[model samples]
Target: MLELRPNCECCGRDLPPASVEAMICTFECTFCADCVAGPLGGVRPNCGGEFVRRPVRPAAALARHPASTVRVFNPAGCGQAEAAR
Candidate 1:
């Protein structure tokens, strides 16, 4: 299951369970569309992978599955050195 992370790793934007703005890499590194499209430049810095829109878990399913409470923030955006790899 996707962790459905609660915030943008790059910019710390709140991305609730149903947010259409959330994007994730295969590793589940979550970031906002702005971060993915702008700073991230359509690439995941940590894994050097492409990103896709995160799926929204239905509200009923969320009650049973529960969205993750952990927040991941990368204030520097994608690390330049890491991205170049």
Candidate 2:
């Protein structure tokens, strides 16, 4: 099951369960679309993998399978990603 992470790993932006802006790598490293297109350049910083849009869990299903509350933020990593780009 996808963790459906709650925020952008790079920017720390809030990404609720249904946000269209959420993008994730195969390892489920979450980031916002802006971060992916900008600093990340569509590549995951932690894993050298491309990103894809994160699926929005159905509203009803979210109740049973809650989105993760834990956030993964790495401002320094985002800076490194920009430099690598």
Candidate 3:
């Protein structure tokens, strides 16, 4: 199961489970619409991949698959910077 992170690592913006604003890459690197559409300009994140919208976990299954308050991710460029050297 994806850790389904709650914020954009760059901006530290909240991305709630049901949020329509959630964007993710194949690795499920989460970002907000604002980040991609505005400053980031649809650039692939630290994972070196494009992003897509995160799926909403159904409310009926809420208890069965509870929402996470914990954010699971590292910022972009950390690995890329190291790889460059």
Candidate with maximal TM-score: 2
TM-score for each prediction? 0.90, 0.92, 0.72
Please, what is the whole-model Cα lDDT of each candidate in the order they appear? 0.86, 0.89, 0.69
10 residues in a row with least lDDT, candidate 3 = 76-85
Using lDDT as the measure, the top candidate is: 2
What TM-score, to 2 decimals, does candidate 3 have?
A: 0.72
Candidate with the larger lDDT of 1 and 3? 1
Candidate 1 lDDT tens digits, 1-85: 9889999988788999999999999999898998887877888776778999999999999999999999987778565534565
Which candidate do you rate higher for TM-score, 1 or 2? Answer: 2
- Rank by TM-score (best first): 2, 1, 3
Global local distance difference test of model 3? 0.69
Give lDDT: candidate 1, residue 11.
Answer: 79
Query: For residues 1-85, what per-residue lDDT tens digits would candidate 2 score against the true structure?
Result: 9999999988799999999999999999899999999987777777789999999999999999999999888877886667775
How many pairs collide in each candidate, listed in order? 0, 0, 1
After superposition on all C-alphas, the RMSD of every candidate to the true structure, in Å, is: 2.1, 1.1, 4.3
